[model samples]
Target: MAKNNEFLWRRLHSLLGIIPVGLFLTQHLIVNHFATKGVDAFNEAAHFMESLPFRYALEIFVIFLPLMFHAFYGIYIAFTAKNNTQRFSTFRNWMFVAQRITGIFLVIFIAWHVYETRWQVAIGADKADFNMMADILGNPWMFGFYVAGVLAATFHLANGIWSFLVSWGITQSAASQRVATYVTLGIFVALSVVGIRALLAFVV
Candidate 1:
């Protein structure tokens, strides 16, 4: 029963990544890309998001709750799992370790990002506009942090997608898994380009 429960939680964890969390990341990048069009475009995008029906509720269910479950359960898995990367020393093994490392960084980055942008705006402490984003990203350290954070996030999501495929029994064979690997790699590269471009829109 204990083993079955663990398996169930693991399956849920993988499923949650692709459903709301992964889909949200893609949507977020698209919205943020509006910054490239200028401040007005970016602000309009922000406004549109805020104008959605039951905005707070949507955020709580679609974003925050899923994120909390994914993040905390991920941490639990990281802590409990036996990492034998040292003995294995293979590409896949390294990526397994990297996944956990990136997850930790992502948790930190996402928390800080949400606090700085969402919570601040919610409390009337800051405006959700291009200038506000530019001001934050214009700083050298902050810019670097954003770059690193986005890279980590994209990689984690990309790898998680591949893992999700396997976990769901969608890619069982070696040939299919290899194809999934290449596809996920492509996703990482594409998302990294979009994410970094959006960040640069703030910097430049």
Candidate 2:
């Protein structure tokens, strides 16, 4: 019974990570990427999202709840799961280690990021505009932190995609898994560029 419950939870975790959570991340990166165009472009995109009907309700139900489950359960998995990187010392083993490390880091990174941006906006302490990001990223330390956060986020999502495919039985063959690795690597690189460019736009 316990094993079956855990299996279902793990499957749910995998599904949620790819569904609303992954989709939200992709939309967020795309919106932020508008920064590369100009302040007005970014602000327009942000404003459009902010103006969506039932936005708060959507965020709570679709984004936050699923994310909290994924994050918290992921933390549990990270600590409990065995990492055989040293003994096995294979590519996938190393990836497993990296995934856990990044997952833990992302919990910290995402919380701080939300506190700084979304929470602040909710409390009327800040605006969701380019200038707001500019003020935040103007500091060298914060800029470095944000860059690291972006890299971590992109890597986590990309790698998580590979895991999601295998766990969901979409990638049954070794060759398919290898292809997934390459595809996800490309996704990581592309999203990293987009995220870093957006951050650079804010500061530079």
Candidate 3:
């Protein structure tokens, strides 16, 4: 019973990780494309989400749960794997590292993002206001960090799509997995470029 429960929970975690957790990040990026419009845009997007069905409750489901599982399991996998402290032992080893490094990054980046966009603005503690997006983007450090984070996010999502597909038994063949990987990579690149450009434009 205990073994079955752990196995079941892990599977459930993977499934939830695939849903709005994985799906939502891509969607979230697209929505945040409006960030180029500045604070009003970001606020409008956030507000729109709040208006959605059982917004708070849904957030608990979408935002908290899967995120916790993915992050926890991810850390567990990372540390337990031989490559955690050693070199990329093999292809599978590198794959795990790729996912884990991005996962770790996302943990920090997302927290900072929430602080900057959600709490800061909500509390009216932000200094940039809506129109100053250009200045924020123009800053060398901020722009650099933002671009890196965007790319990392894109990579994370792309890799996650592969993880989700294989876990779901959607494609078992190597050829199919390779094709899916390429397709996801292409999509992430396109979205990241568009999102980054939009943000840069908005800031200017």
What would the per-residue lDDT of candidate 3 be over residues 106-135, giving only the tens digit for each residue? 777777776776667668876433454556
Question: Positional deviation of 73 in candidate 2, in angstroms?
Answer: 0.3
Residue runs of model 3 more than 4 Å from their true location after superposition: 35-47, 84-93, 122-138
Question: Weakest 10 consecutive residues, lDDT, candidate 3?
Answer: 127-136
Model 2, CA-based lDDT: 0.93
For each predicted model, how many residue pairs clash, with residues at least 3 apart or on different chains?
Answer: 0, 0, 3
Best by lDDT: 2
Native-to-model Cα distance after best TM-score fit, residue 200 in candidate 2, in Å: 0.8
Ranked by TM-score, the better of candidates 1 and 3 is: 1
TM-score of each: 0.96, 0.96, 0.79
Question: How far is 122's C-alpha from truth in model 1 (Å)?
Answer: 1.3
Q: What lDDT score goes with residue 117 in model 3? A: 62
RMSD, every candidate, angstroms: 1.4, 1.3, 3.3
Clashing pairs in 1: none
